[model samples]
Target: MTRAPATRELRAEPVGSLSVWQGAALYVGAVLGTGVIALPALACRAAGPASLLAWLGLVLLSVPLAATFAALGARYPDGGGVSTYVRHAFGARAAAVVGWCFYFAVPAGAPAAGTFAGAYVATALGGGRRTVLGTAAVLLILVAVANGFGLRVSGRAQLALAVLLVTLLLTAVVTALPHARLRNLHPFAPHGWSAIGSAAMLLVWSFAGWEAITHLAADFRRPARDLPRATAMAVTVVGVLYLAVAATGVLVLGPADGTSDAPLAELLALGVGGTVHVPAAAAALLLTLGTMNAYFAGAARLGAALGRDGALPAWLDRGGGVGEVPRRSLAVVTGLSGLALAATAVTGVGPQPLVLLTTGSFVTVYALGTAAALRLLPRGGLPHRCAFLALVAVAALLVMTGWYLLWPLVITASALGYLRRRQRRDPGRGVITS
Candidate 1:
């Protein structure tokens, strides 16, 4: 077997200490957020009962993707997650491109998610769009504060919220299951398998954040041993929860009724009592908030890691006191997220469009990361062959789900330009490595 270089020998510094459970919580919290709550209704509308097929397809694709990430994390337990993995497997230029893509996706996703959370809160509070905007602002500020303190503090809150969200969702599912009408499943493929595939593309976004935990692999207690287990557990739990909630939404509301905006909330209101709607709305808000916090933590760290590597502004590398927060990077994240919120509010583009715009960029990152896994796999063996084939499949799926690849390409070109400028300033200075 070909052994990879030790993290310490490679001069990779550990930023914080995070146990397996905490890391798992971060992963689950990020992966299960607002998308899980919102997408089932849309998926049902898009594919009818056949949306279940989309869910299953996503699960199958996601498991191997998650496992590939876990294996990469085990081999390269360093910060910057996918970027570092890509750099180790490929080279600095490719890693730089991946870093930019991942970084952009974070802010791109923030506004839509924040808006969704805000909308849920507004409904719960009997307010309007203004209230939703206010809620979004408040959520951004809260997440920034929590993350600025450190991952440990933010991660604990995230874990608690994840548990609460899962419990509430599961309870709602169970209650609604008894009320399921058999007629709801008729005309399973209302549109066609093509539509199901399209819906599956959208649903896959809900599963995107599972790999975020790989960014903090060095922080794990025993990353090589625990990383895979934590990643698998997180993805499996989130997948099961997603399917359960989707089923509950279909069961109680029926295909026609459940196709509306807030299907889960509608189901809870019907299955339990009208009184449950308020709490369900509140749960949705909290779930989105948890996701925002989780992403904030991961994105800031990625920025700091990029800064450390001289791909971004160098000030971001400065660490916080106890929580391992890069204070400068946190500021950047807050500012960018705030800007995104403002832009979305002004333009009136909802979550779907925002998510669609960023999905291509995210898929590109996944493709590159998976390709890196293939390259880094133990050389000259069946393991390498299998890894290469899996990576190829992932790459093909990314291309098949074409939304907008140009955004990622533009961001990468900009990063490359910045890198070139820095290199010219100091010709002999070597690029930072994991």
Candidate 2:
């Protein structure tokens, strides 16, 4: 089936194959990634113990933001995700912009995510840059191959990854708590209160994935019945684990929390009282795999949908329908990810910048996605209320994102340009809005 997959017209999945637990696992896998391994330390550097407040604040914001996407996903149940919502609310041109932002951001972010996990592997195995690059290449390829088989395989793999990573995180938190010194809380605002904003910007990387699962919402056995349930489960798990880990890192390691190479590894070692790099590396691998798997699946499907809707090339529309694997679009995503990794390796750019770039794009997506929800959802309903709240929060995030928004802006122009060019070529198939 991987060869061009199946050809079918656009339709809501006849019946989704994913169960509630599986959907929840996919959500967890998408949102809980390498950020847990390094972001707490990075945020602590940006704002000291005050970073905990930043983490908590994001977890709180997640309620409405996640709800907004879940509501849209449940209502639409299409692979186009926010792009589909935007198409319904605004028009084709705007939906294309949303699609391009998300579809392209996956590749830009893949190198960063892969490198994070690879760094852990290198630290554990003593291979350094080569190990990091090799590990990243392998992960990208594995995730691509898995998704090429369709969600049946990738979703289950994500479930397994979620189970493992969640257990490791909880264990690290529980065991490390005894060693946490209350003194760590003393210098909470050491970087000054303004630094909390910086920390929140960095934490946006950790929070970006909440919208990703919307692309796969159609795969749920009963999207309307199961999407919100899965979202709630994922939000609770992600919030608790993130808060627990952030607090544990700050309390146990104090100033060192801001500088640790692998904060989660150090925390686990302190609790377990021995060398834990190997298992820590394993957990990192699972985390990266889960993240890449989810994104590859969602992005591939979204690409096909964009293609099917004439936002992207018709050649890519082969797998836009339900029960079809977007192998062609998957190939495009994988190729772009490899090229992104290569560019970073050659140019000596760091993961941090790539992360900010990714976050910027995702924030732009959330801005438009929430706006689309505000228009598409029933007025005066719970979903509409959540969308309103989410739109407000996303606006704040846009300002915080600063110059990092440049990438998505360029992508926006590119999307619009591509559409205009297509319109000039085929006036019959063009519209300013869908």
Candidate 3:
């Protein structure tokens, strides 16, 4: 077996400026994103009260997944993130597939996330589909504008939003506990026990960010030591919050939990008792802004990097350099996301399919990343063990993902086709368009 270079073999790597606390904050921001806006309700609908099991399962699963990525990051420490690790473990062909999956996933997924927040706004303002689509459209535009203009939201501001999101969610769960009834637990698996697997697949969106922070691993002051600590802290916080919210939705809202698109807002209304719409919508939108903005910037930059690396068309490669604004890449992402949103609105298919599609892509990335970890990390070590477990888990997730996996499969083919064509043209090193 041609194994990757073990961690101990690499020496004299440069350290970075981020502390444990800062790294943890970044992880929180990355993983605890806009999915929380509506996932509990959606998952509840999928599996009735039993969706809590899926939530808990995903939470528990995140630890090994997070650890696997952290171990990979501490060793390779590249901005290429999963693509870099895949390259080391497999080859450039496989790496390109990972890059395409990730880059294209943002466009496919962003609309769903925006629609999640949009549902909250619609719930608050009473505009129904019009309001929801309008809000989602505005969000997509704002994210593009922010990234295109080089407008940066400070880390402290993002941290504040994360804190506020957690606190608000906890408040809803705690205050609403008084209304929770044991009766709601009855008929737990209304859709059958098999529904639990479906819920687990949908909930993958909630836990998809473990590899995101890997890109910044080199920026951590001590990647080996601090990466795991940050991952652990983020896992604990995100798990507790997700569990509390899902459990509270099941118990407090009962049948309503399976219906409402804006379940968090509903929870706030039930908990706070009267007139929580403004505050709830405001909080949700602010948090969504922070989450989507960061995602847009990151995905745009990744698209640029992929383009520059010949994994994508070179038209996007212009802004891959440090401090350069990836306007072309950003435009493509924004345009694609907008089209996705428009299609969903016209077809009235809602965000569930979008969520599944995005989750499908992430699961593919996770599978490859974990498989890479098994080869990259030292043999007979704890990290390797975690990676093995994570690989098994992700394989199961990819299965649960079912038909949605088709999307990533198509992306994989496109990536390979692009690489093959580019190789034919250059017959050597790849060239750029602009």
Best by TM-score: 2
lDDT of 1 by residue, 126-236 (tens): 678887788888888989998877777777887788788888888788877888887878777888877787677677668778667777777666777777788878877
Q: 253-273, model 3: which lDDT tens digit per residue?
A: 899988887778788888898
Cα lDDT tens digits, model 2, 107-178, are 999999999999899999988998999999999999999999888877787888899999999999999999
Count of clashes, each model: 0, 4, 0
Question: Which residues of candidate 2, in runs, are more than 4 Å off?
Answer: 1-14, 431-434
Ranking of candidates on lDDT, top first? 2, 3, 1
lDDT of model 2 at residue 94?
A: 81
- For each candidate in turn, the TM-score is 0.91, 0.96, 0.91
Best by lDDT: 2
- Whole-model lDDT values for every prediction: 0.75, 0.89, 0.79
TM-score of 3: 0.91
- Return the TM-score for candidate 2, rounded to 2 decimals: 0.96
Please say which candidate is ahead in TM-score: 1 or 3.
1
Which consecutive 10 residues in model 3 have the weakest lDDT in total? 3-12
Cα-based lDDT at residue 38, candidate 2 = 76
Please give the TM-score that candidate 1 achieves against the real structure: 0.91
| Cα error of candidate 3 at position 397, Å | 1.1
Q: What value does the lDDT take at residue 230 in candidate 3?
A: 86
